[model samples]
Target: MNPLAHLRPALDAGLVELGLAAPALSARLLDYLALLDRWNRAYNLTAIRDPREMVVKHLLDSLAMAPFVGDETLADLGTGPGLPGIPLALARPGLRVTLVESNGKKARFLREAVRRLGLANARVAGCRAEALDEPGAYDCLTARALGTLAELVRVGGHLLKPGGRLLAMKGLAPADEIAALPPDWHASAVHALRVPGLDAERHLVVVTRRAA
Candidate 1:
C-alpha cells in the first residue's frame, strides 16, 4: 500500500481548487511527495515532516505558480530539494527547469530525483546562483524562500535575458523589499497566491530589470 495514499483526496481537492485538476498529475505529485517524504527522514531535506502538511505546503504551494509560468527555460536558484522547480517541471513537461543548489547533499538528492522521476525536462546545477556562468540564458527565474529581493537580484540577476523576470515566492507581500530593490531592478507585479489548506499569506513577486 502506498503510504501517501491517504493524503490523495485532499491533494486532489486542492489541485481542483487551483484549476490544475488531473488524475495523472495528482498521481505524479503524490509519487514525488512520497519520494520527498522518504528522503526527508534521512536527509532532513525539509522541516515539514508530516505528509499532509507536505501536500499543502510543498505540492499545492508550488503548483500555485503554475498558471504564471510560461513554456520557457527557467532557473530555480537556491532550490533546496527542488521545491517549485521539480513540481513545476512535473506539471509543465514543456518547461525546461534547472534546479540550482550549492549544497552538495541537496544537489545529490536533486540529481537522484530527476533520474528517479524521469524528468527529462529538468537538470541540476550544483553551484551557487552567483557562480552559475549562464548569463542571459533563462527566460525566467524562480527563487523560493531564498532571500530579500535585492540580494536575490544581486546574485542571480545576470542569469536572466534582457526582458526576463524573477518570480520570487514570499510568505507575505514585501513592500520594504520592493523599495530596497537596486536602481536597475523593479517589481513589475505582485501576485497573491492562495494555496489550499494553507491559511498563511503567500505572494509571488514578479521582478524585472529597469529599461536602460
Candidate 2:
C-alpha cells in the first residue's frame, strides 16, 4: 500500500476530531508531511524518522493549537520546517503567517514548502526572533517547543500587537517559566490540548502584556 494511503485515514480522522474537516485543508496537510519527510532525509530537520510519528507529533500536534489562534496575522518564531505555522496557514487561508527560522537550510526548506504548497498567505523570514524589530506588527505570535516562556517573550514580544497574544506550545505546563515571566507580561490562560493520536501531555500557554 502507498504510504500516503496508510496515512490519509489517520490524518482525516484527526482533522475531523479537531473540527477541521475541510477536505482541501486535509490534503494540504498531507502534502506538507510528504515534503517534510523528504526534506528530513537530507536536512535532518526533525529527529522523528517514522512518518506515522510525524503525522501525530508534527501535523496533529501543531493543528491542536488552531482553535486558540484568532489573529489575522501571526508570526511563528523559530519555525523549523514550518511546523504549526504552515499547517495553520493551510487550515486558515485568510491568516497571514510569517515563519521565522534562523537556520539557512531550514529557511530554504520553508521557502520551498511555501512555494510548493502555494501558501500565498505564508512567508519565510530568515532571521532570529529578537532580530525582528517590527513592534506591534502581528495580531498573534506562536512558538512550538522553541524556548521557555520568558525567553520567548523577551525575543518575540515586540512582534505582537498591543492587544495581541503569544501562543506557546509546550509538552508540559511550565509553571516555573510562567512564574519567571517579566513584570510587564502576564499569563492569560493555559489550555490543555488533546492532540488526536498523541498520548503525551500537550499544553498551550497564552501570554499577554500587563496594562499600563
Worst 10 residues of 1 by lDDT: 1-10
Deviation from truth (RMSD, Å), model 2: 1.4
lDDT (C-alpha) at residue 78 in model 1: 94
**Cα lDDT tens digits for candidate 2, 95-196:** 899999999999999999999999999999999999987888999999997889999999999998889999999888989999999999989999999999
Model 1: pairs clashing at backbone N, Cα or C within 3 Å: none
The lDDT leader among the candidates is 1
Residue ranges of candidate 2 with Cα displaced over 4 Å: 1-3
Segments of candidate 1 deviating more than 4 angstroms: none
Query: Residue 129 deviation, candidate 1, in Å?
Result: 0.3
**Model 2's TM-score against the true structure:** 0.97
TM-score of 1: 0.98
Per-candidate clashes, comma-separated: 0, 0
